[model samples]
Structure formats: C-alpha cells, structure tokens
Target chain A: MSGQTLYDKIWQSHLVSGDDEAALIYIDRHIIHEVTSAQAFEGIELAGRSIWRSDSILATPDHQVPTTEREKGKAGFVDKLALLQVTTLDDNCDKNNIVQFKLNDQRQGIVHVVGPEQGASLPGMTIVCGDSHSSTHGAFAALAQGIGTSEVEHVLASQCLQQQKCKNLRVLVNGCLPLGITAKDLILYIIGKLGTAGGTGYAIEYAGEAIENLSMEGRLTVCNMTIEAGARSGLIAYDQVTENYLHGRPYAPKGAMWDSAIQYWRTLVSDADAVFDKELIIDAKDILPQVTWGTKPDQVVAVTSQVPEISSAKDAVQQADWQKALSYMSLNSGTAISSLSLDQVFIGSCTNGRIEDIREVAKVVKGKKVASTIKRAMVVPGSGLVKQQAEAEGLDKIIMAAGLEWRFAGCSMCNAMNPDSLASGERCASTSNRNFEGRQGQGGRTHLVSPAMAAAAAIAGHFVDIRQVELAQLEGIH
Target chain B: MAAFVAHQGWVAPMDRSNVDTDAMMPKQYLKCIFKSGYGDWAFDDWRYLDAGDVDVDVSTRRKNPDFELNKTIYQGASILLSRENFGCGSSREHAVWGIRDMGFKVVIATSFADIFYNNCFNNGILALTLKPEQIERLFELSGDKAMSLTVNLQEKRVTLANGEFYSFELEENRRFKMLNGLDNVATTLLKKQAIQDFEKQHKQTHPYYFTPLR
Candidate 1:
C-alpha cells in the first residue's frame, strides 16, 4: 500500500462517507463570523432548518465591527449598514442558541485568531469557517478550510460537507530563517515563487526544517495566506510547538483526554515514503524581509529589491500582468521597493495581530515617532485578549507612544469591510493580506509586509528593510 | 438553486490576470443583508467612477465607460472572460452571487481560485477553465466586439460563434449536479442516517472532539 501524506491521513480520519467524486466530510468545528454567516443563517431560517450541532460552532462579529470608539459600543459603528450586519449576527446567534462573544466581550476578535486562542481549533479536527482564512487553523494539524455561505448553510443543516478530493502538494522549506525574517516573509516569498494560481486543485502540506522551526503564531501566519496561493487549505503536521500553544486554552482537551489527543496528533505526520502529486522546495535562507510591489500577492520582491521590470516577466501573461499592476499601484518600473513612501501604515489582521506580532511592532518603534509624512499609523490587535495581553506587557504603550494609535481589535484595516481602511488614492504599508486593487478602499494601494517591516515603515514613512533598522531596535525579534 | 443546460451569451473580456472576488463584489457591497442587490455593485469600483456604498443609490454613481462590462458592446454580456486565478482572495460567495445577479451565467478563465470556483456551481453558474493558449485565442477572437459563445455543460464544450468548440473537463458528479441543478444540501441530507451513524462511532474513537470547549 502507498504511504499516506499528512493531508491524506487527516482526510481519512474525517471521512463520513463517499469517495473521490464527492464525499461527505464531517466538520467538527464551524467558526462563524458576521459578514458571511448572516446570509447562511437566513438560509437556514428560510428553509425551516436547525443547526446539526450548535455546540460545534463558535460565533463572533469581526469583519464589520468598529475598531475604535469602543465606549460607544455598536453605536461606535459609523456606517449604518455595518451596524445592521453586526446586529443581525447577534440576533441570529441568539435565536440559534449558539455561544457568541459579543462586541463587549473580550473574547471577540477575528474568527481565525479567536478560534485557536479559545482552543476550539484542536488537532485532528475538521474546522470550517465562511471566511477563507480558516486555513489558519491548519497550523494545529486540523483539516481546516473555508466554506462559502452556501456550504455554511449546508453545515448548519447537516454537520457534513460534501467535497471532492483535492490533490496533495508539499511545500518544503529547508534551512534556518535569518534573525529578522519572519513566517510572513517566508510565505510571501513562496507565493512569489509559485504564482498565485499554482496551488489550485491541491491541498498543501508545509514541511521541512524551517516550517517545523516556526512558532505557532508564525505557522498560523503562513497558513492564513494559503488561499492567496489559490489553495483552499494548508497544513503543518502536529508537533510540540502546536501542543504547547494549545495547552490550557479554554477549549483544549484537559486531563486524561489530553493524553489521547496527543497520541492521535502524533500519528498525523506524513509517512516517510508518502508520495505527493507535486512538490516545491525553497531554502529559508534565500528569503528576505519581503514586500509586495504589485496588486497580486505573488508580485513580490525582497525589501531591498526594486520593482520588477516588465521585460523581466517569465511569460507573455506576466509581462502584461506586471504592467497592469504597475499602473494600478502608480509605481514605475525599476523603482526601489524601499523608496516607496506611504500615506498610512497598518499593522493588524489575522495574519499579524497576535501578541508576538504586537511585540515585534513595539520592538521596532519603541521610542520613535511615526514619520510626519505618514497620515496615520495604528496597531489593531487580533482579538480582545491580544489587546489585553499587549496592554499587560506594556507593549501597547510602547506602540502608542511612538505616535501610532494602539486601537481596539477586530478585522480592522485588513480589507475595507470595517471603519478602519485606506482613504482614496492612499498608499499603505500593510501587514494584512490581499493588496488587490481597491482592497483597502477605492483607489487605495497596499504593500503587503510583515509586522516588523510595517512598524519600521511607519517610523520611516517609507518601506525599509527591517534588517536595516538600527541594531538596538531589533533586540527581541530574533 | 437554478438549473443549467446550455448558456449562450456575449463575452465580456476583462483581459486581466488575478481578478479577485474583492473586484467581483467589493467589501462595501458585502454589507447587503440579501445577496440579490449586488448586481449593480458587482465590480463596483471598476464599473462605476465613484466609490460604492450599500446605503447610497447605485444609480446615482457615474458609470465608467472604460470598464469591460460597462462598455457599449459588452453591455449585458453574460460570459465573463479573464486570465489566470480569477476570483482569488477572500471566500465571499457575494462574488458569485453578484456575478450571477449581473446575469453572468458562465466564466471562462485560464484558472480560478478554489473557493470561488466551488461557489459558482452552488449558485448554478458555470466556471470554465481553458488552456492558456485557448484563452488567449478567445481573447483575440472577441477583441473589442460582442462575440457570443454557447457553453454546453452536457456536451462539455464551449462553442464559439464560428462553430469551433473547445472541450473542457468536468468531473461526473459536478456535471450531473450542474445539469440537474441539484441542491447539494438536499442531497447530503438524504444520508442523515449515515452521518448519525458516523457520529455515534466518532464519539467512541475520538470523544475529545465532541467535548465542548466553552
């Protein structure tokens, strides 16, 4: 018999029924958020259906939550439509009897962050959310993937999701990362190596030395952008890093159950001779503190590099793509990525709003003020807990004192869904994913970077190599 | 929820790569409670000169004559043609809903994002993938004009107006579902007994999964 890959092993364990053409995969945890779940709830209500297991779901309002003026509560939401979607979520969860962390709840944050933090995203489980970043939970060896609103309704009506088999692809990152290079830089570099569509029709398992060396926060960041590479899901085998992170979370298994959980997680690794349909290997040492130069995530280069010339495109399609992106971003060919000035610098989102990410930001800008040329700079923590923890460590004070607003948490400034967003024609050095045209706002341009890079950009008013930031400022990042 | 047989529509060539769902349905329009009104707002930032808002009237917005869909020749074009990785980015079904609401029953691209491709079938929209050369050829065939194509799911081919058809692959189950317009949830519910049985056994082997975390 052929050896099974990690995705295959986890997939077999979750199989409820059927085969490759279509299979009913049992979903153990369904993470729900406001923007996507509202319609799904409406669908179930219209169909006269109830959730298969309300306990299996965790609900929160993140995408549309106001990230500032928390004293006003929901009234803080300046957009009435945003307020409506958020309140509708509360009503749906209330009617369905599902547990939800409300706006005032400290547990509330992005679904991707809150799920793992609360321990709902456990190893060897199948977790689905309406948002694509559900892949973030795959860091714990869970079969996590995003579902659309239609599938979300199906999961609510029936805890099983019908799926076709996805081919297994392995991304092996070898060697050790440099001192300041992060999981964000590594993943961005990988996406650039493999074009945006490279992972289509495949489930990617990230393996090798560097992936194993990543902290759970870093692993989550890598998995969060799995969709950006066009893969529905990304996974890393369960390890001590995962177990340590899951330990003592409110939702994690306790006592003797922990033993059984670990024993099962141990078997989640790929067999030695497992064959993957495709494989891409990268040396971690080859990666630099990366930054995106174009609208597409794959249009990235090292922070020290210049915007790629159209003549350098590998194919006819890329040549055209390069030109289009250069036009949309208002950047000329051959401009140094570091010389690009920014109107705003945003540090937050599921990808980089964790406590570790916050600490990195603080370390970079501890006593420095945001550059005067920058219009605004802010740090939105991933969740209420992340904010609380940052405050406890006085990291928020360090950030705020650097002339950047240490704001409340949600999916703030990641996309234009919330009150926090880029103004028209503004160029921002952002830690959030997706620099797609107008993703931040209409005519808004975004440069995707790591927390440390975005922090340094906020201070310098331009993209700068984090490695070039003064030595004293880089103290704790390594 | 709608049945698909064959679709014949004018091709609206976007001629761009990596066209994301955020472009299909921008974040501001996602605030709509129902999915239907996204028609006018689909490609809101590109289709209109002004920034879109769910609260404001879409009619008041100035239409950008330069946008492919807004062009006089491609007006009401129901087949969206684009380059690789179309519908990449966030998993918003609003992307599919808005495209469908705008009357696009089919999309032909070099490739598509996983989530958006899946969402298309659930909404009775046909998402087709052709080889890069074939897509480039189609772009040349439909340059700056209204060119209609017939997308036959049954035949598993798309026939250009010149009677040349390009074959595409669709797995049997997905083809069957598209042809009959199957509501996947209804079909899955038929196996409730099987799911219940699985649950019973799952609890025995992995009781930790069933334990409530909160």
Candidate 2:
C-alpha cells in the first residue's frame, strides 16, 4: 500500500462512503456567517428540508455588520441591505436551532477566528465554511476548505459534502524567518512565486522547519490565503503547537478524552515515505515582507523592489495584464513601491485581523503618529473576543494612541461588506488578502501588505519598508 | 436544478487568465444576500464605463466598448471560452450566479479554481476543462466572428462550428450530477442514514465540539 500524506489520512478517516474519486466526506464542523449562510438556509426552507445536525453548525454575523456600533451610536446595521442580511441570518439560525454568536454576542467575531478560539476547530477533523478563508482551520491539521453556497446547503441539510479528492502537494520552507518578516509576507510571497493558480487541483501541505516553528495563529495566517493561490485547501500536521492551542479552550476535549484526542492527532502527520504530486521548497531567509502591487494576489513584489516594468513581462498577456493593473491602480511602472502615497491605511481582515496581528501593528506604532497626508487609518479586530483580548493587553490603547481608529471586530474593509470601504479611486495600504480591483470599493486600489507594513505606511503616509522605518524618531512625535 | 445534457450557443472568447470571482461579482454586490438577479452585475467593473449599482437599469449604464462582453461581436453569446485559471479568487458562488444569470450555460477554460468549478456544477452550469493547446485553437476559432459550439455532456465532446471536435473528461459523479441536474444537496440527502450514523459516532467520540444552546 502507498503511504498516506497527512491530507490523505484525514480524508480517508472522514469518508462516510464513496469511490476513490468522489466521496461523501463527513463534516465534523460547519461554520457559517451572515453573508453566505442566508441563501443556504433559505435554500433548505425552500426545499422543505431541516438542518441535518444543527448541533454541529455554529453561526455568526460578521460581514455587513457595523464594526463599531458603540462608537457610531448605532444599535445595529443602518444600511437596509446589511440589516436585512444580518437579521435573516439570525432568523434562519434560530429557526434551524443552530447556535449563533450574533453581533451582540460576547463571542461574536470573524467565523475563522471564533471557530479556533472556541475549540470547535480541532486536529484530525474536517471543517467547512462558506468563506474562502476557511482553510485557516487547516493550521490545526483539520481538512478544512471553503465551500460554495449550494455546498453550504448540502452541509446544512445533510452534514456531508460530495467532494472529489484533490491531489497532494508539499510546500517545504526551511530556515528561520527573518526579523519583521511575517506569515502574511511568506504567503504573499508564495502566491507571488506560484501565481494565483499554482495550487489548482491540489491540497497543499506546508512543511519543514519554518512551518513547524510558526505559532498556531501564524500558521492560520499562512493557511488562510491558500485560496488566494487557487488551492482547494492547505494543511499542516498537528504537533505540540496544535495541542497546546487546543488545550483548555471552551470546546476542547477534557481529561482522558483529551489524551485520546492527542493520541489520534499524533497520527495526523504524513508517513515518512509519503509522496506528493508536487513539491516546492523555499528558504525562509530569502522571503521578505511582500506586498501586492497589482490587481491579483500574485502580482506582487518585495517591499524593496520597484514596480515591474511592462517590458519585463514574460509574454504579451502578462504585459497587458500588468499595464491594465498599473493603469487601474494609477501606478507608474518602474516606480519604487516605497515611494507611493496612500490615501488610507487598513489593518484588518480574516487574514490579519486576529489579536496577534493587532499586536504586531501596536508594537510597530506604539508611540508613532499617523502621517498628516494619510486621511484615515483604522484597525478592525477579527472578532469581539479578539477585541476584548487586545484591550486586555493594552494593544488597543497603543494603537489608538498612535492615531489609528480602534474599531470593533468584523470583516471590516476586508471586502467592504460594511461601510468601512474605500472611495472610488482611493488607494489604501491594506493588510487584507486579495488586491483585486474594486475589492475594497468600486474603482478602489489596494496594496496588500503585512500588518507592520500597514502600520508603518500609516505613519509615513505611503508604503514604507518596515526594515528601514525609524521607529525611535517617530515615537512621541507628530 | 436544471439538466445540462447538451447545449449549443454562441461562444465569446475571454482571453485573460486568472479571471477571479471578485471581478465576476464584486464585493459590493455581496451586500444583497438574495442570490438571483446578479446577471447585469456580472463583471460590473469591466462591463461598463460608469460604476454599476444594485438594480440599476443596464440601459442607462455606459457600456465599455473595450470589454470582451461589451463588444458587439460577442453580444448575446451564451458560452464563455477563456484561458487558464478562470474564477480564481473568493468562494463567492455568486460568480457562477452572475455568469448563469447573464445567460451563459458553459464555461470552457484550460483550468478552473476548485471552488468556482464546484460552484458551477452545483448551479447547473457546465465548467469544461480543455487542454491548453485545444483552448488556444478555440481562441483562434473565435477570433473574428462569434463562434458557435455544441457541448454534449453524455458524449463528452465539444464540437466547434467547423465540426472540429475536442473530447473532455469529467469525473463520473460530476458528470452524473450535471446530466441529471442533481445538486449536492439532493445527492447528499440520499445518504442521510450514513451521515446520521457518522454524526452519532462522531459526537460520542468528541462531544466537546457541540456548543450548548443557551
């Protein structure tokens, strides 16, 4: 028999029944949010079907909810469309008997953040959600991926997804990460190297020294953007980091059950001789803080590099794509990225809105002031829980004192599900994934960067290489 | 669900690669939770010169003559032939909804991102993958005028207007689902007993996952 990779082992274990090509993978947990789950619940009701197991489904309202209701003096969503969607989600979850962490719920946060924090996502299980960043759960060794709305209904109605197994891929990163280089940069760099479609038809397992050394939250950030690379899912084997993160959480197994769970989790690693359809190796030291200069996530360059000239494009297609992106972004080819000006700075998203991400930003901007040229800079934590934790640690105070708006949690400006959006022709230094045109708003331009880079950009009023930032001089001065 | 056994329609060639879901249906449209009525909104930014808003009349919007879909040659086309990695970003199935609502039934690409591919099948739209060279040939065929092609699911072939044929392969399950118009919700429900049994055993082994209802 062929040796099994971590993905193969978990997939096989979750198989309820099917052939080699297609299987009904038993979903251990289903996480849903307001934006994607409404139609799904509506679908079930239209079809006269009840939720198969509401007990396993956890609902929350993230997208389209006002992130700072207390600050804005608004009780709930003021936009009619946003109000309708959130209310619909609440009604649907209630009708289905599914537990929901609503906007007012103390546990309310981004779906990806809340799942791991509540211990609902665990090692050796399969998790599915409606948002593309669902792969974030794979950091715990779970076989997690984002499903389409119909598949959402499928999971809701039957708790199973009819899935064709993806081929295995291994991305091996060796060596230690350089100082100030983050998981976000590493992933953006990976996407930059592989292009957006590099991992098509494959489930990638990130391995080696760098992968093993990343914190659980860091690993989540790495896996969160697997979709940005066009991979179905990303995985990492469960190790002590995974165990420690899961331990003592609200839903984590207890006592002897925890011991047994750990025993099972230990088996989640790929066998020594396991093979992969594709393998990519990168030296961690070679990676630098990355930022997407163009529309697609893969249209990226290191912070130190100049925007690529159209003439340097390998083919006519790439040249044309570059030209279009540069025109849309109002960026001149061959210009240094560090010299570009930013109209706003946004440090939030499922990608970098976690507590750790906030801490990184707070650390960098502890005593700095937002630049006069920067119109607005804000921090939207991933969840209410993350906000509370950041407040507890005084990360919020540091960020607020640095002249950045510290708002409540949600996917604010990540995809413009709420009013925290960029105006037409506005350019932003963003910490979210996906630099696609109009992602933040209509005709809005985005430069995807790490949290520290975003913070530095806020202070500089333009993109700045974090490595060169004079933090000491900026501190306590306007 | 509607069956997609065979279809014959005018083909519009979109030469660009990595046509992500965000471009297909921008995040601005995600605010409207209801699924249908997104056809006019598909490729919203690229489709028009002025910004398109929800429920805005398409007639009033200034059409972008440069966009592939807005070109007179490709008007009324019901099939989209594109290059590699079509629909690459965001798991928003609304991308498929917009494509379908725009009246296209089949998307031919050299490759597709996984979620977008699955979303197409679930919505009764056929997402056909062709070899790169074959896709190149199709692009060449649709270069001048709008080309018409016949896609047959059972025969597993795409026949060009000139009678040139290209064979494709689909996994049996996906093929079955498309031919019969069955979605995952329907097929999965058939295995309710198995899922129930698995859930029962899963809960017993790991009861920690379930949240107590307040």
Candidate 3:
C-alpha cells in the first residue's frame, strides 16, 4: 500500500461520514472568542438548540476586551459586555457544562496563546475558532482553521463540523538559515515571493532540514503567518522538539500514557515517499530579515532593499499600485529602507509576541535607550505566562528602562481592539503582520518587521538592521 | 431590483495584495455594530490625517493628494484593480465595508483571499478576476483620468466602457447570494419553518427527561 501523508491520515481519521459534496468531520476541539461568539450564542438561543458535548468546547474573551483593564475586574458595561459575553459563554457552558477560562481565571489571555499554554491544543485534534488566525494552532501538528459565526453556531449545536477536504501542499525549506535570519524572516520571504495567494486551497506542511531544526516557538511564528500567505493552515511534522515542548504541560498525558502519546505523535509526521498534490521548495540561504513596505504582507522588500519604484513595474496596474503605496507611506521610490523614521513601535501578537519574542527583543534593547524622537514604543507579551517569564528574567525591566512601554499581555495594537493605536498618519515600526492603510489606526502607517527588528528600529528612531548592533546575548541561545 | 448592467470603464490600477479588513475599516468605528455609514470611515485614516478631519480639500486631496486613492493613475476609479491574493488576513467584513464604502463598485484581481471575497459578494460588492495580462492592460488604459468600467452581474462579464470584456469564475451559491444580497444567516433563517418542524418532531420522539450527571 502507498504511504499516506500526515494530512491524509489525520483527515481520513477525523472523517465521521462523507458523500461527494461534503463530509461531516468530528471536531476534537472548539475555541471561542468574544468578537464572533456573541452572535453565535444568540443564534443558539434563537435556534433553541442546546449545546451538545459542551466539555469539548472552550471559551474566552480576547478580541474586544482591553488587556490593560484586565486587572481591574470588569471595567464599565462595555468591558462588562465583553465580560458578559464570557459570562454568557460560561453560563451556557455551566448550564450545558462547557469548560472556560474566565478573565480572573489563572489561564486567561488571547485564545490562541492560552490554548497552547494550557495543553488544550494537542496534536491530531481538529481545532476551529470564529477568528481567522486560529490557524496559529496548527503548529501543534493539528488540522486547525477558523469558521464563520453561523458555522460556530452549527458546531455548538452539533459537535461535528461539515468541511471539505483541502489539497495538501508540501513546502520544503532546505538548508540552514544564515545568522540573524529567524523563522519570521523565512515566512515573510515566502509570503513576499508567493504574492500572498500562493497557498490558496491548500494546507501547507512545512518540511525539510530548516523546519525540523526550528524550536517550538519558531514553528509557531511560521504557522501563525500561514494565513497571511492565504493558506488555511501550515504545520511542521512533530519530532523530539514537539515532545519536549509538551512533556510537562498540564493537559499532556502522564506516565505510561505519555509514552503512548509520544508513540502516536511520532507517527504524525508525513510518511516517507508520501505524495502531495503540490510541492514548493525554498532555500533558507536566500531569505533575509524582511519588512513590509506597502499595504500588504507580500509587498515586502529586504531590509537593505529600497522601496520599489512605480515606473519600474512592467504592468500598469502594478505601477499604479506602487505609486499609491508610495503616496500613502509618504515615501518616495528609491529611498533606502534604513533611512525611514518611525513614530511608534509595537511588538506582540499571536505572530511574534510569545516569550521567546520578548526575550529576543530584550536582548537587543537591554543596554540601549529608545531614541528621543520616537513618540511611543510598547512590548506586549502574548500571555500572562509570557509576561511572567519575561519579568522573571528581568526582560520587562530592560524594556521599561530603555524607555519603551511594558504592557500587559493581549493582542494590543496588533489590531486596534484596545486603546493602543497609532494616531492618524503616524508611521510605526510594528512586529505584527499586515501594513494595510489604517490597520494600526485610521491613517496609521505600519511597517511590518520582526520583533528584534522593531527593537532595533525603536533604539535608532529609524528602521535599522539588528545585525548592525553586536550582541553577545542570544548568540549561543537557540 | 432591476438587474441593470452598467458599462465597465477603464480598469484602475490594482492595490497591493493581502489588504486586510482592519486596514479597510479601523476597529474604532466597529463600535457602531451596524454596517451602514461605515463607508465614510472605510479608509478613514488614509483619507485624512485625523479621523473625521480631511486636512487637504476633497478636490485637492483628489488632485494634489498624498493619499493612495488619489494618485493620478487611479483617479476616479469605479473598478479597483489589484494583484493576486488580495484580502488575506482577518475575517472582519469591514474590509468589504471599506471597499464598497469607498465608492468602488467592482474589484478586479488575479485572485482573492476567501473570506474578504465572500464578504464583498454578500454586501453587493463585485469581485472581478482576470488573467494578469488583461488586468495589466486595464491599468495601462486608465492612466490618470476618470474611466468607466461596466460590471454586468447577470452576464458575469466585466467590460471596459471602451469595449474590452473579461469573464471570471464564481461559485454558484456565491453568485446567487451576491445577486440577492443574502448571507448564510439570512439564508438559514429563510428555512426557519422547516428547522422548527424538524426540532418539534425530534423533541416529540426523544421525550424530555433530565438526568443530572453525578
């Protein structure tokens, strides 16, 4: 018999039943957030359908709630509304018996960040959320993706999900990354080359020498940006790195069951000689620390490269787009990227706001002070645990002493769901993905870069290459 | 509603790929919870340096503008032209809100990311796709003037008022929804009676008996 790819094996195993058009796939885990779940709960009430298998469903309030006000209990009715949404979810879960991590609960943060920390996100599980970046969970070697509010309602009513099988694409990144290039750079380079839509209609399996060498945190960063490239999910084949990350976690199996879990996880890798519908090969040597120059993630150039000239584009539409991007950014073509100044800097999100990202930024900003000209710079960790870890290492003090704001954990400024945002027309060097017009705030200009790059830019008050600063720290670290 | 076919004018230049929903409509205005009037705030930050404040005059902003939309090559565009894989991040319908609110009737690109494209069709926004060469030609002709691009929803054809035509593909369900302005929720609600009947029948057979888990 021919060997089956991990995608085929997991997908086939999850299939409850199927016909030609669609299949009912049993979902292993369901995560809910405030922004999309409110309406879903309303739909459930309207439909008068009680939630079945509430134990498998998990709820949290992340998107709309303010991370800063998290400590003050619930602030006012709006915050209370968000709290009420969580309460309603908890109440519904309580009435039907579903598990949730409330705001005051020990495990509370962004849904994606908290899911993994609590060991709720396991391999071979099919996870779904109402938010798009739920693809971030696929790093655990699961087939995870997002759904609409209506679909969320369906999943709540029935534990099963109706899904179409996705085509598998094996993206092979060979060779080792050059010094100073992280997984953020690798994925950014891929998105830039692929033009964002490169992975449509496919679930990408990141393989080869480079991916296997990546740490768990690094794999999460790559998987987080898969959606930015228009792929449903991106995953690495689990190995010793995966086992080590999950070994002591709360929800991971213990003792003899742990050995069995590892045995099953070891089998989660793509079978040798397994066929994939599509294949893409990228060389790690070719990638560099990247930054978004335009309104999109794919419209990026190397840190050393100049903003692309509109006149140089062969297509008139592309030329016009180039001109528009230049106009909005208030940047002229041929200007060196290093010459650009920044008003603000933000480093946090599901994308690069984990503990490792905080540590990396702290190493660069420790001895350095943020430039006086820069108006604001903040480092929001991905979760409470990440914040605690950074503080334990004195990384928070380093960030604060350098004159940057050390914020409470949440998806701050990544999306303007919270008070943290750029004033209109304010240009910022952000570690978060996407630089579309007004993404950070109305008329806010965003330049996407890695966390370390954002730290370097914050210190210089302009876009600067992190490699220019010699750091004895993070040299021998993974 | 009349299924009138409008003539396609010149194809304006395409925007960069992966323009997210948040960039289309900043989260500040999402507080309203209603979909209407969001068009004014569609690219509020990009349209003005401050929200609700347009520093440069509208005509001058349209003329001597530093804004992306006012650039000479893409002036007075009815149809927006873009590269492949447009609208990639965040499933916020605001991305479509911004696109439609900005007075763009149609968006032509090589491809569109799933959610944003669906949101566009659901809100009466047309996504016209074509080969790269054809899109390139539209941009060449649009050069710094007001050009008319006609979109015929019934025929599913995009025509430049000057007489170039292109055909694109869309799923049948999406086509029906776009033409009628029906979303999944609205469609589901249409089957309310059938759903109610099914529930009633199921309830009758199952019989309500509660046994608390110990």
| Native contacts kept, each candidate | 0.79, 0.75, 0.28
Candidate 3 C-alpha lDDT tens digits along A188-306: 88888766677887888999899888888888888888887788777778788888888877766667667766767788888898888888899999887888888778789889989
Report DockQ per prediction, comma-separated.
0.80, 0.69, 0.19
Clashes of 1: 0
- Winning model by lDDT: 1
Stronger candidate by DockQ (1 vs 2) = 1
TM-score of chain B of 1: 0.97
What's the best-to-worst order under DockQ?
1, 2, 3
Cα lDDT tens digits, model 3, B1-214, are 1122444544566445445566566666544333445555665555555344212233333332666575765655667877776776777665676676667778888787866665566556778678878876766666556567777777777777667778777655556656765544444444445544544453342221011111
User: TM-score for every candidate vs. truth?
Assistant: 0.98, 0.96, 0.80
By DockQ, is 1 or 3 better?
1
In model 2, state the lDDT of residue A361.
Answer: 89
Question: Ignoring the other chain, what TM-score does chain B have in each prediction?
Answer: 0.97, 0.96, 0.73
Best by DockQ: 1
For residues A138-232, write the lDDT of model 2, one tens digit per residue.
99998999998989999888878888889999999999999888999999988887778899889989999999999998999999999998897
lDDT per residue (tens digit) for residues B129-155 in model 1: 999989998999888788999999999
Give the range of the ten consecutive residues with the poorest summed lDDT in model 2 chain A: A469-478
